[model samples]
Target chain A: MSLVMAGVVGALFGAGLLVSGMTQPAKVIGFLDVAGGWDPSLAFVMGGAVVVYGLAWRLVRARRREPWFDAAFHLPTRRDLDARLLGGAAIFGVGWGLGGLCPGPGLVAAGGGATTGLAFVAAMLVGLLAQRRFARG
Target chain B: MPTSWLLALGGGALIGAASALLFLTHGRIAGISGVLGGLLPPAAPDRAWRLAFLVGLVAAGVAGAVVAPSAIGASVRPLLAVVAAGLLVGFGTGLGSGCTSGHGVCGLSRGSPRSLAAVMTFMATGAATAFVAGVVS
Candidate 1:
């Protein structure tokens, strides 16, 4: 039941990505290209999402102590900022600018059978594995 | 606001609602990288929900392609660029412990300082990279 609910939530999220034009590389690049012809559409998307989620977070916390499906809420507890976080984000930013597709949109597009998406996902998996190996060693 | 901007906002709302739903029901953050990354070694006991969510995400992508083709755009970047971007994205997200959905949307909604820092770093670097790419290309 919880798994089904998770799927439903994922579907809704993916639909949102499509509707917000996040699946389009050109649109993403346009938004990132602040020095060029900047498109503020992505900003609206982020703003709208953040507002809604923020409200929901407050409401849910006020009403519920625990989730419906899980015994405890699995929220991140880390408060400290470190070099790993900053360096990783910097690298991600460069990749995002170059390809204009992050993990969510990349997965959605690949699932829809785009060759480029597939290629990107494949390389991404490789990178993930490589990073894991390096981290372990 | 333009019609497109409204759509973007609405879509973003939907995304937020989905994230909220996941949190409210399952006590989980809709962080794509973390959800997907946890499955790399497949040791976690809550893998079912994660897999289900990804399946639903992919299904939505397929449905969106059929229902609203125009919103899903094709990639114009070359194979080499796409692959390189994918590598960077995967490795960076792994090291950073979050991506756009996790850090940009969910984390910001929760008002996490780490997330704020991550978003600022990524946005700055992303915009800078886009500017450089524009100048070169």
Candidate 2:
């Protein structure tokens, strides 16, 4: 059941990726262009997402527990703003801005049937490995 | 623009909804960046959330397809490449302490200085890759 649900989510997410034209690298780049023909779609996408999330988070917080779930809410524990976190974020941003296929879109693409997504996903993993080599206890 | 915009909005909602739901239920974030990041040096507890998160992600895709049959695209990337990318992302997540959504959506929104840094780096790298792959390579 859970596995099936996961696949369904990926498909929906991927469908969204396709619909948003994000699967096309050029579109993603356009959005990132800032000074060029800037595609404000990214902002809209983010806006829509954050808005929904904000509402969900508020609802969950009010309940003190997630309805239909088994755990308490979690917020970040380490607030030191360390180098590892910063470095990782930078790498991730570069990848997203460049490829237009961060983790979310990658999974969606994988489901949607894009081979380039494979490359993006692979490189992403390698990046992960490199980061782990320096993982702290 | 309409196809992409609508899709992007819907996609963002789906992605956000899944993550939000999971977090609300599990008290966890669905940032692939962080979940994969935590998996390195994997053991029992570390694997639990990581696996669950992934399972949930995949399940979501399947469900999305069934719910909205029209959204499915008829495209396929090389399977080998896709698997390779997944492995690479596994590694990247380990090092970076998160993947795109983990850092890009959840972390960045929360004002995590690290997520901001991570987002910057990857966006650049992705752009560099696209420039090379799409234009140069």
Candidate 3:
């Protein structure tokens, strides 16, 4: 059941990328180029998503229990803007501007058959693994 | 009708829908950062939820390709660059204690002040990253 769900979720996410042209790095680059050719399309997408998620959140919370599965709600507790956050954001930005492939879209790109995605995914896993190895309590 | 708009709507809808589904079925917030965080240690008895969440995420992409042939295709971005970017994000997520899903989508929607700060940091870093990459490379 989990496998089926993951596959479905991944597909929809990928399709979103494909449909939004986000899976294509050039498009992302184009959007990033403010002076040359500023494409605000991604921003619009972000806005729309924000609106939808806002409403859905309410509907979900209204129910005593969730509509489908059983699990606890999770949210971050950390508030300080520390080194990890600062440094990581710096690295992520560099990658986005240089590579235009963040984790979500990167995963979607790989699923779409981009060889480069394989590398990104591999590195992402490594990053995840590295964090696990060195995580502090 | 427009390709760009289509892309935005599609991605946004998928993400929003997935967010809603995750919220409905599981009481989980559908934030990627938190979802991945569960992998850390002592393996919570609720490990099944995390596993299921990740699986559904991937499956969504897989099924989309099968059904939406027009949506699946290779992408750009060099492999090495993307790998570096992935590592950066891994580190960033660790530091920030969340990612776009947790903050940009779920956090902000939930009226989380911290999420607002995190999202701001994410966009600022993203913008700066693009600036340097554009100028340097």
Q: Which candidate comes out best when scored by DockQ?
A: 1
Model 3 agreement with the true structure over A1-137: per-residue lDDT tens digits: 64456445545544555566565666676677665467778765666667887888787777655345454555456555566665555555666666676666666656545576667767766776677667654
What does fnat come to for each candidate?
0.78, 0.40, 0.49
lDDT of each: 0.89, 0.57, 0.64
Per-residue alpha-carbon lDDT of model 1 for A74-132, expressed as tens digits? Answer: 99999899998998899989999998999999988887778777888898888777778
Lowest-sum lDDT 10-residue window in model 1 chain A: A126-135
Q: Residue B120 of model 3: what lDDT?
A: 74
Candidate 2 has a DockQ of: 0.34
The numbered model that scores best in TM-score is 1
**Candidate 1 stretches greater than 4 Å from native:** none
lDDT tens digits by residue: candidate 3, B43-90: 455666666666655554555556664554444445666778778776
The residue ranges of model 3 lying beyond 4 angstroms of the native Cα positions read A1-10, A65-67, A77-83, B40-45, B60-77
TM-score of each: 0.98, 0.72, 0.83
Cα lDDT of model 2 by residue, A1-137, tens digit: 44344434434444444455555555666776565566767666666666677677667777774434444466776656666555554544444544455676565545434456545655666666655554643
Q: Rank the candidates by DockQ, best first.
A: 1, 3, 2
Off by over 4 Å in 2: A1-15, A66-69, B1-3, B38-40, B43-49, B52-96, B108-137
In terms of lDDT, the poorest run of 10 residues in model 3 chain B is: B69-78
